[model samples]
Target: MVTLKLLLAISTIKQWHTLQIDINNAFLNGDLNEEVYMSLPKGLTVSLSSCADPPLVCKLHKSIYGLKQSSRQWYTTLSDALLSAGFKQSQADYTLFTKGQDDQFIALLVYVDDIIIAGPNLKLLHQLQHSLHARFKLKALGTLKYFLGFEIARSERGLFISQRQYTINLLEDTGYLGSKPAKTPMDPKLKLDNIQGEPLADPSQYRRLIGRLLYLTLSRPDITYSVHTLSQFMSAPRTTHLQAVHHLLRFLKGSPGQGLLYSSTSSLHLRAFSDSDWAACPLTRRSTTGFCVFIGDCLISWRTKKQPTISKSSAEAEYRALAATASELTWLQYILADLHIHSSTPAFIYCDNLSAVHIANNPTFHERTKHIELDCHFIRDKIKAGSIRLIPVRSSLQLADAFTKALSSTSLNSHISKMTVHDIHRPS
Candidate 1:
């Protein structure tokens, strides 16, 4: 998903033509190396069978849909074809293939059989499409508008991606289409725990709901934290969890078409915001790490996850968040390099915790920071290598705060607006 968003953002910034392609019978294209036998069909009567011959089995020579190795073999076959066409596979992302550079640059991202081809040159894209068609049947969908349930709207301003239909379907299926609307996905004052209520009678519904909500977060970052919080109780979801899910659905009903906008006027430079909520989890006492990465003004990546280890202090939690943010930025830098977008300036990372900032810049470790010594070294290395610069920000101005914890309606709206989330289907 990060790679997909990055590709779209780059294409938007470059004003390139982004097209989609599908491989017909993609799994059947792979050549099987191992010897495998299959039973003959029940209805087929061979000539030998009429002669009272022994029961016969068919030897498989090619990959098939039900085979476990089909997907891998198909990817191998496709990679070989792309490589033969002078396209270099990205080490940062194996699914991404690039050919040429600058004005002649063309990038192809493959998600199983579906593909997205982006570049400024239409002739080259068409040529590549034709080439792929010769190797394997291709269904070229000109001008990418939808892929993997994401509805994209392209314009001079940029690309607007949403899952309006997806959200509506979820609401309709859950019988929440006409439910009372919610001002926010989760209540700011609410603290959910595992032992809050009796176990649900049927947990599969809750699990399925969480799974769908997880995919919905692809375009709706506003619900990410809430979804992340609810996902933890998938195994033994209770009545209270279901109630919370209902609230989240009501929130979705309010603005089903809300999504992110990748702006064309945005710069190519990178910046990020890192934040953490110390001891946010009442049961585990673990902190939640949140971060958002941007290419100029366009947000390409963000994450909301709980820390693996419990932090003794708020500074340690904040520092851990900073380290995680640095790791994501490093990967984004590599991805940018693969996309031929280079930058010498170090990416700026804003943290509202002053102690965390000092801990990152100051190498000297004290008794309070010894437990997180490794985190300190990791953050300092990025700082010394000029990969990222840590900046102090006020708590009110922290964009990542929304991700780390539930926020008030006003605060959530303010943060979501800054993240470029909008409802395009609403009255203008």
Candidate 2:
């Protein structure tokens, strides 16, 4: 609650003020665990002979932590309390509850037992909290300093999300804190082939290493591609592959605090960029397709992988990529519909390949597109129905370019600048 108030303070000047609230006796207040019974808590069970019946186990009239249904009962209790107090849950996030009008909105986010309270209208926040406090015990934790692992900092630019401390711990745990730095997470000159190299002496150790690296991807886009490549050889890893994995750890050492930073001033429109490099895999002769989805300014999801089928033409490769991206877009449309946050305009899809864009917008039978799979035709239907509109972007500005293939440092940095990252905090 304090953190949200702080966020409102940064964004709204004095127009918004937050109220800090803590639900007192939150767990104890809930009606709970009718099935639970205990022997008189160690002190009162000694005198059973005086009564007509043997000393009966004390019945639990309320919920306690160990019982299976404790969590459900507690949630139901809290939910009823809030609903009675003029609050309604958000359709998008079940954890979020809201009340009041647009500018005067009061919001509460519940985390298990802890609750965060926020509102631009301070008077409303307090009255709600006061009513709750009158019924239950409550404590106020002034301002949110840290929640859900990400450190909070509200400023002119926006809310900066980073995991500087967490990254540092990862470096230390992997024994890479003192390793020399590398310019990039991946070496552009290297080529990976699955030739079934010498197997690891002990496979469990390699599993542990990859497990840690996967978690690191949360903040490090630079490593995402390289980590993905190395992961393929987990079953039979060679010394060369192990060295490549070490190189990634060294890259982490140089910038242990780097992570994604989601800022406030970002576009809310649903836009996706899809691109594919034709016949990029030397061994398989398969193409690679990469796509990124963004909501407003915040990046929601991204993926890069080799396509299942070999494409005879570049247009074929791009059409396959479009099909993959279209599938993702369709899922997002349904998600938004559930939240009642439908796009005001048709969702925009940006692709650098004119051949693929033409195939999507028009259903004409060019000899090249005839061989494309039946699944690929569905994208054209979506375009004609006005669910997704395809737009042509110049090669240089194509954001999906990074995910499709390796690029020069200058080009790589340019593409990185277009990412959702707002800042990197090194724990200073």
Candidate 3:
């Protein structure tokens, strides 16, 4: 997903043309070197040879959909073909292939059989598509309006990627299309727990709903905190948990088209914000880490997750969040380098906790922090290597604050806009 976002960001910046292709029956194109036999499918009458043919069975020559190795075989075939075409596979993301340099550069990202091709050279893209079509059954999807549930809108300003229809479909399926709109996805005072509500008669529906919402977070970072909160109760969701899910649906109904907008004028420099909520989880008393990464003004990556261990202090929690953000920034730098976008300036990690900032900058380790020594060491190493810089910021201005806790409408709206989230299709 990071690779895809980076591709779109670069395309927006370079004014490149983006195209999509779908390989027909992609798994069927795999060449099988092993022998496999299957019972003849029902209703297919094989011609009897001299009326003495043994009980009929079929021998497979190529990969089939149900085979365990089908996906790997198909990818091997695709990789071989792309590598043969002089395209270099990205070390950061093997699914990405690049060719040429400068204005002639081309990038092709493949997820299974669905491929997104982008480049400044239109002729080269077409020629490559033609070449792919020659080797495999290819369906050229012009202009890349939709791919993998993300509706992409392109203009001179930039690209807007959303799951508007997906969101509406979910709302409709859950009977929330006509529900009252929610100013926020979750109530600021709501504290959910496993034992607070009655066990649902049927928990499968709750599980399924949470699963879909998890996918929705790909574009709707606004609900990421709420979704992450509700997801914890999936095992045996209660009435209260289901109600929270419905509340989230109401929020989605308000702006089904809200999504990330990658601005064309955005710079290529990387920056990030890290935050943590101390003892946020009611049941576990564990801190929650939240972070968002941006390439220039465009937000590309963000996450809301519970800390793996209990934090002894707020500083510990905040430092852990900084370490998590630093790791992500390092990864983004690698990916940016793979995309041929490099910045000599070290990426900045903004934290609202001054104690965490001081600890990160201080070389001396204390006995109280021995349990968290690993995280501390990792963060200091990043800072010393010039890969990241830890800076303290005001809590009110921390963009990742939304990810760690439920916020008032005003605060969420402010962070939403700053994160480049737009609702061009919001209902009146």
Candidate 4:
């Protein structure tokens, strides 16, 4: 359900008209496989001793909404119906179904029982409704104003997808609704280190805090570094680490309405930025790898993870970052090809390290890079094959740097602004 909702949230930015509909009594339509029985309700069988035998149990002939397998059963019923109607399920994404007749096409995306129908056929969409209503109790919701978490709006200029309500609720839940705002999520001067010291009072509370901050990444990438740093101490959190998490909540208080803004544009370029910190972790010498993927100006995917293997040098750490970026770009290219949206422009991968770029373009097997030769060769191969081109982007221009380490308030603001996340305000 979350996956389907996220797709609609993203496609809204493309200015495509949307329609949301829900199946009434969705679970009751499914056929039951076994003879399931439930105890009678409290009102029923008022006098248990009055009955000759035990009180009769209500036998379930069809699936109900609250059953464990109810959703999956209803999904199967819907899939069979769509398949019989000549719609083909997308191999890449199961929730997506497509039907086309020459120039006319219709795409149906389903979130459990709620669905959004889009294509070039309003007439056919109405026809589809008549047929669907006959099979199951369904209501056609007028032009979507809000679907899932995003509050949607469309005008002559473009479409707007925002989660203003969600953000406000987050602030209230974290007790940041009445707190003073911090200029930045974290202070650069404060270096977080795990000394040989005692852990916090309650480890579970620290974990709960980290979990919420992770979800905030949906709209606030600025807090990505602070959250990433605090996650390392989940098993045994210290007082200092908990303090850092609290500071981030204060930051969230300031920008409760922020969310990613995907402007309507027509460019098919796959660009990415790769960055890594060299031996930054105090406990372990492992560096963090971070990258962000963009489709034209749309921010689609980003990741921040600790390197799997320890690198002997900074060059090796940077090389691992490139390979991670390549994997993401490859998946993205495949997804585009499936959608018939091929990029005419070549994809560019921006890396901060000069040695990594040289290792990608150069064939020399230096002894220093021998240990990670196989990993280093992927970039060299991709560069030679023209799948990706490595360009030198100045360190200051690197957005992924925000994910690698804590930065000064000025640098934090700069990178956060570059992300282009807008404040999701209510309609005036």
| lDDT, candidates in the order shown | 0.90, 0.69, 0.89, 0.74
**Residue 285's lDDT in candidate 3:** 97
Q: Which candidate comes out best when scored by lDDT?
A: 1
Q: Give lDDT tens digits, candidate 4, residues 226-278.
A: 88888888888888888888788888777776766666552457788999999
Give the number of the best model, judged by TM-score: 1
Better of 1 and 3 by lDDT: 1
Model 3 clashing residue pairs (backbone):
none
Q: Where does candidate 3 stray beyond 4 Å?
A: 30-59, 373-376
Sorted on lDDT, highest at the top, how do the candidates line up? Answer: 1, 3, 4, 2
lDDT for each residue of candidate 2 in 374-417, tens digit (9 for 90 to 100): 88888988888888889999989988887777666677778777
Instruction: State candidate 3's TM-score.
Output: 0.93
20-113: candidate 1 lDDT, tens digit per residue: 9988763364433434435566676677746676566564556778888888888888899899989999998999999899879999999999
* Location of the lowest summed lDDT over 10 successive residues in candidate 4: 1-10
User: What TM-score fits each model?
Assistant: 0.94, 0.71, 0.93, 0.81
Better of 3 and 4 by lDDT: 3
lDDT for residue 223 in candidate 4, whole number 0-100: 77
- Poorest 10 consecutive residues of model 1 by lDDT? 29-38
